[model samples]
Structures are given as C-alpha cells and as structure tokens.
Target: MTAPPTAPATSNAVGRRVSWQTGVSILVMVCAVYLARRHWPVIESGAARLAVADRGWLLVATAATAATWVCSALAQQGAVARPLPARRLVAVQFAASAANHLLPAGLGAGAVNLRFLTRCGLPVGRSATALAVKATAGTVVRGFLIAVLALACPGVIHPPHVPAVAVAVAVAVVGVGVVLLKGPLRRALRAVLADVRAVHELPARAAALWGGSLAFASLHAAVVIAVTQALDLPLPPAQVALAYLAASSAAVLLPTPGGLGALDAALALALTLAGAPGSAAASAVLGYRLLTVWLPLLPGLLALGVLIRRRVV
Candidate 1:
C-alpha cells in the first residue's frame, strides 16, 4: 500500500522534470528558427538570386566548412598524445558539433567529448584534459590567425561596427594569452599534470598542438572565403576571409549553446558591412548554419537515442 503511493509520486516527479527540460529545448529551438526566418526576407529580396548565379563557389565553401571537422579531429589526436583511431576522433568531432548546438553554453559539447573519449578507452582524466586542451587550443589558434589576417587586410575585416568588435577580439586574445603565458598558468598546469601523471602526461611539444590547431583554423578560413564567393557577393576574398574569421572568433565568446543565433548575427552583420548586400551575407551565413549545424542534428539525435537506450551516457 505504501509502495503504491511512493511509485505515483516518483513517476510524477520524473514527468515534471522531463517536461521542464523539453520546454526549455523547444523554447530555444523556436527562438533560433524565428531569427533565421527574419533574415529570410533579406535573402528573398535578392540574396538568393545572387547566390544561385555562383552555386559552385558556395559548394566549395560548404565543403571547406565540412572539412573543418576532420581538421578538428586531427587536432584532438595531437592533444591526446595517444594512438586514437582516426574514425573515433572524427566521430567525436562530428557528434560534439551537433551537441554544441543543442546543449547549454559548452557543457553539453564538452560532456559529449568526454563521454566519447572515455568510452573509447581513455581514462577519465586524460580524456577530459585532452578535450579542454583541444578546445582552448582551437580558440587560441583561430583568434590569433584571424587577428593576423585582419591586420593585413584592414579594409575587409573592418566592416561596419567592426572596429569595436575587433578591439574586443584583441582584448580577449591578449587576456587568454596572458593567463597562459604567465607563471601562474604554468604552475596550475604543472599541478594538474602531477595529479594526472598516472592517467597521462601532458604533451611537451606545444608546437604540435598549435600546428594541429592552425590546420583547423586555416581550413575553416578557406571555407569562409569560399562561401563569400559562392554567394556572388562582390566582397574581396581577403576581406571575406577576415570577416568570417572575425565573426567566427567573436562567436566563440558567446555564452549561448554552440553560439547559435549569436554566431549567425555576427557573421551576417559582418558580411553585410563588408559590402556583400545584406541578403547575400545573411543567406550565406544561414546556409552555412543549416549545413554545418541543423543538417547533422538528425543523425546526432539518433546517436543520442542509441546512447541513451544503450545506457551509454
């Protein structure tokens, strides 16, 4: 009799929690879809027509963006310093990209990475730290390379309101650099290394990590330029590269899960100011988002279901 009452209460509690979680996911999805639609009018006006004229370029850009996943996986392999299978690394990268779009801030993305690696045979500490290093390295390399390009091609990178955002980017890079270069960072890392020595020692060749990161950065930069051309926007390749790089780097700072609407806004706005008509820029960015994010979501959802049903998570 007492057990019967407890079962009802427990089931109700689970139902309420699931309801709340589902509600949050739906709310976020709606807002994102709405913002994307708002930008549709711009493209409808002329952007679509312009992009259709040079579909090949857009295809190239889309390909480049897709290739960034492979580059990311290679970077992770370097950071992990273990002989991880290439297939597994790619799986983690692709899955993490999808998870990032849906999860809060970066926790879900990071958690997916951790889970993927650990399940692949790495110990918990090594897996988590490798993920941290890989993520941070990606951020650093992308921002640093973009800053260099922006400086070289000022006209392209300094779109409308770009000066203010560029300043912020510079500050963020410097701040992270300072933390990393300062003695405190080394000390803290050493402490972590000492504790995790049994799991895996942090790699000594910092250059290798940066090299892998650079590859990831460079390939994605190429994609941005490709997208610019594909849209038939009259922007210079150098300028488009700079704009995409800047928008993308700034997007990393956004607290929203996977940068979502925030990233879209940054990319579209930056492109618009770079002389690509608003519609052209918005459509290209929208297309990129759809391909890079939404397209993979279905597969990711299946993976999530499998993982959950298999008790993998």
Candidate 2:
C-alpha cells in the first residue's frame, strides 16, 4: 500500500506551525530592537548616574533587586498546587523579567511562565488560572501597600483634583464596559476565585502567595529608596517608597514594555512633586533603572536562551 493520505496533511500542518512560530520570533526581535534604539539615551544616562552613586547605598539596591526575582519565583510557586523545581523556578523568573522588558503589559513574562507551567505537567487551563491568581495577588498587595504608605506618609503624594463631570463620565464609561463584558468577566472571576480558594486552603501556598507578592512589591520600592539615598536626593525613605508605589501603579495604565519610558517619566514627576529637585529626581530614576533593569538584563536573557535550548520553557 502507498503512504497513508494523512501523512501529507500532518507534515503540512507541522510546516505551517513552524512558520508561524518563526514569524512571531522575528516580530519580537524587531520590536525589541526598536525599543532599545528609542531608549538608548536613557540607558546611557542611567549608567552614568550609577557610576557616581554612593557605592554603599548602591550595594543595598543591588541586593534588593536580586531578592525581587526570588520573591517572584515564590509567588509563582504559590499560585500552583504542585511543587516546582526550586532552582529552575528561580531561573525562570529571572528569564521572565528580561522577557517582561521586551514585551508590553507583561505579555512576555506571562507567556514564559505559561510555557513553563505546561512543561511541568499542568493543563493549559490550570496554568492560565494560576497565572491569573498570582497576578491578582500581586495587584492587590501593591495597591494595599500604596494605600498604607500614603496614609503613613501624609502629603507624600497629593491626589490630583478632578472635575466632577470628568469623574462621572469616566465612571460611566467603566460601567458600560463592565456591562458589555459581563459574561466573560464573570467567568474569569469565577475561575480565579476558585483557584484562590484552593490555593489558600494550603497554608504554605497561601503564605507564599501573599507574602511573596508583598515582599516583591516592597523590595522594588526599597530599590528606589536606596537609589534616592545613594544620590542624596533629599527625600525621606517613606516618601520615596510612596512615590515609587504610586508612580509604578499609575505606570501600569500605559502598556509599554516593563513600564520603561512611562514609569521613568511618572516616577521622576512623582519625585519632583514630593519635593525632590528636578535634577536629583531624574538621577534617582536613572539609578533605579540601572540597578533593576540594565544590570541584570543580559544575564537574564542568557538564562532565557539556555532554558530554551534545554527545552525547559
């Protein structure tokens, strides 16, 4: 008998899939190159600032930056019920952070983690749910910290005055959107709530989820604070922390990769409003970016390449 008719169809399908993946990889590389070109000046400035920053305080910021990756790994683990290989989990988080910087609104990081979870034997639906749980926890913890810090350091961040009519229109728009998307929204909410309940039933998982998220946010703020201290930005630690939280939270509204440009502008402005001189605020922002983004970026990307080569993610 001749070859089965289905063999040709299977080969064609495999060829199409490979082509699609290759196209996507090329597009991602193009976007990354464009972003790097656009942000080169800022990166150079940040590096210059880091060179002159107080070594002691810079060391503190560096340490905090390293810890944030560990916190991310812990939170991710807490999202799923099954145990993940500890070393590989942390390495993936590092890789994810580099990916986050390359794609908008956390898409790269999410994709990386989703692949990792599926590789580790989780069903696709469950892996997605776990990601949602971790993201929800992170958002809640960040907002809680902002609110607490705002109250503790009154006047650190002044609320912008909004026209009543403008506020009403915004609320109305959100209400209409919610009504339109209620079905999908409801389903997603239910799924996330179910996962949350299941994860919380285990004390270790619950603690890791909440504690790791809290620590992750706190450590990031600490990095900014340390940078400010290093450069003598004349801002109190609490105020710097509040500025970081508020700026970063607001920056989420703009879906640029890793909050790159958007976060830089918002953070500098927040610092200025909090009484730091413009130059000093700019330096502190640059310094923060240097330690958090530029420094670890290459190593993270290398780790990502290695993981891919090993078919680990």
Candidate 3:
C-alpha cells in the first residue's frame, strides 16, 4: 500500500518538473522571437553596409576584437585577491561577451562571471566586488583616453554646449541620495571600497588593473579605426578613436544588449559629425559591428556551451 502511494508522488514530481521545463522553453522562444523582430532593421542595414567594406581592413578589425579578451582577463585578475586560472579566465571572458548580448544592461555577463569566479573559490560577495572594480577601472580609462584624444584633436571635438552636464550632475546627486537611503546598497558599496583598497595594495595587480583597462579601451577604439580605414573613410585616426571612445562611453548609460542600436547610431553620427561622408560613416559602423559583435557571436555562444558542459563557467 505504501509503495503504491510513493509511486504516485514520484509521478507527480516528475510531471511538475516537466511542466516547469516546458514553460521555460516557451518563454525563451518568445524572447528570441521578440529580439529578432526588434533588431531586424539594424541587422539588415549592417549587412548591407558590410557588403561593401574592404575585406582586408575587416580582418584587422577582427584581430583587434580577439585581443580584447586577453585585456579583459588581465583586468579581472587584477580585481580580486587570488589569481584566476589564466587559460580558463580568458575563455570565460570570450564566453561572457556572447552571454552579454542575451540580456539587457550586462546582467548576463555579470552572472556568467559571477559563476566563474565563485567556481574559482571566491565567495559571492568578493566576486561581485571584483566586477565592480573592473567596471570602474574601464570607465575611468575610457574617459581618460577620450580627454587625451579630444585635446590632441580639438578641431574635431567641439565643446559641449548642451545642458547635458547639468543633467548628469542632477542624476549623480539623485543616485547618491538613493544609495544613502538603501541599506543593502550601502553595504555593497562598502564591500566594493574594501576590495578596491585591497587590490590597490598589490603593485603588480594595480598595474595590470589600470593597464589592462586602458588597453581594452584602446583596442576597442583601434577596431573602429580599422573599420573606418577599411571603408576609406577620410576622417583622421585620432578623430575616429576619440569619437569611438566618447560615443561608446556615453552609450554605457543606456544599456541595450551589447549596445546594439545605441552604439551603432552613436558611432555613425559621431563619424559623420567628424566630417566623414554619411555613407562612409554607416559603412564603418557596420564593419565595426560585424567584427566586434556579429562575427564572434556564434563562436562565443559555442564557447559558452563548451564551458558550461565542462563546468568551467
């Protein structure tokens, strides 16, 4: 009699599991369809623009794109107290790039990295702090590069005339107010500050953190330059780099999956404003996206799957 009752319970548990799995599958399918429909125009335009770009320059852009993974690994290593496995770390960065596109505002990448770091034996809190540190370093380096380039080519980068600065200040003030009001956020901030201090105490890690951050931003800008050159865009390389840094940095405020629409629009607009023909600007933007986002996407996804199967991420 007891065996018969247990069998029904087991069957009910299995049924519930299967139902949950089916629901999740349907949700994923819905999301996929939605994203595809929404991004179709950008996809079509990028394809058209890339069809005419010089293939050789595209290869250089692709190469620069590959180097970004190494830079990211180095930066991540600098963020934590313990050293991460170098080979696995680089692979995780590559995989994270693909994951980054699947979710809005970098949640996918952060989740992947958090998993990887925890698997490497760090506690969850420290892993999150490491992410925060790397992000902070990357933002600072991008801003520094933009400033330097703007000074180098003042004629290309016009002064800011809009009330954007005031708006940004107001936003910062509001953010600070919120942070102060939120207890959990306050604790998180304190932990991040502690980790920042710990990481800065190690000279080698400090250098790697800042150097890798700078290199990552520079390589990204180099990718843009290669794309522009491939299209024979007449804009100067410095101007292109400056525009890329500024546009991409600004695009961070509006997080769309890998900055798909936002970055593309900003890049094309910045390039045109920098004196490139509209067609050339579009071509360059398309080529850059092709190398950085589209081309590697499949491989990155495959790598993500492999890492999951191997239980590496």
Per-residue error (Å), model 1, residue 139? 2.3
Q: How accurate locally is residue 239 in candidate 3, as Cα lDDT from 0 to 100? A: 96
lDDT by residue for model 1 over 15-91, one digit each (tens)?
Answer: 88667656644554564465456645643544444446467876776677678778777777767655677765676
Off by over 4 Å in 3: 1-52, 159-176, 179-182
Candidate-wise lDDT, in order: 0.68, 0.89, 0.84
Weakest 10 consecutive residues, lDDT, candidate 3?
24-33
Give a tens-digit lDDT track for model 2, residues 1-313. Answer: 8867898899999888667655655554565566567778878888887788899999999999999999999999999988999999999999899889988999989999999999999999899999999999999998899889888998787788999999999999999999999999898889889999999999999999999999999999999999999998888899899999999999999999899889999999999999999999999988888788876776676677667656678
What lDDT is reached at residue 176 by model 2? 99
Give the per-residue lDDT digits (tens) of candidate 3, residues 112-187. Answer: 8999999999999889999999999998898788889988999776656769889899999999989778998789
How accurate locally is residue 246 in candidate 1, as Cα lDDT from 0 to 100?
85
Off by over 4 Å in 2: 1-38
* Model 1 stretches with alpha carbons more than 4 Å out: 1-53, 155-188, 191-208, 304-313
Clashes in predicted model 3? 0
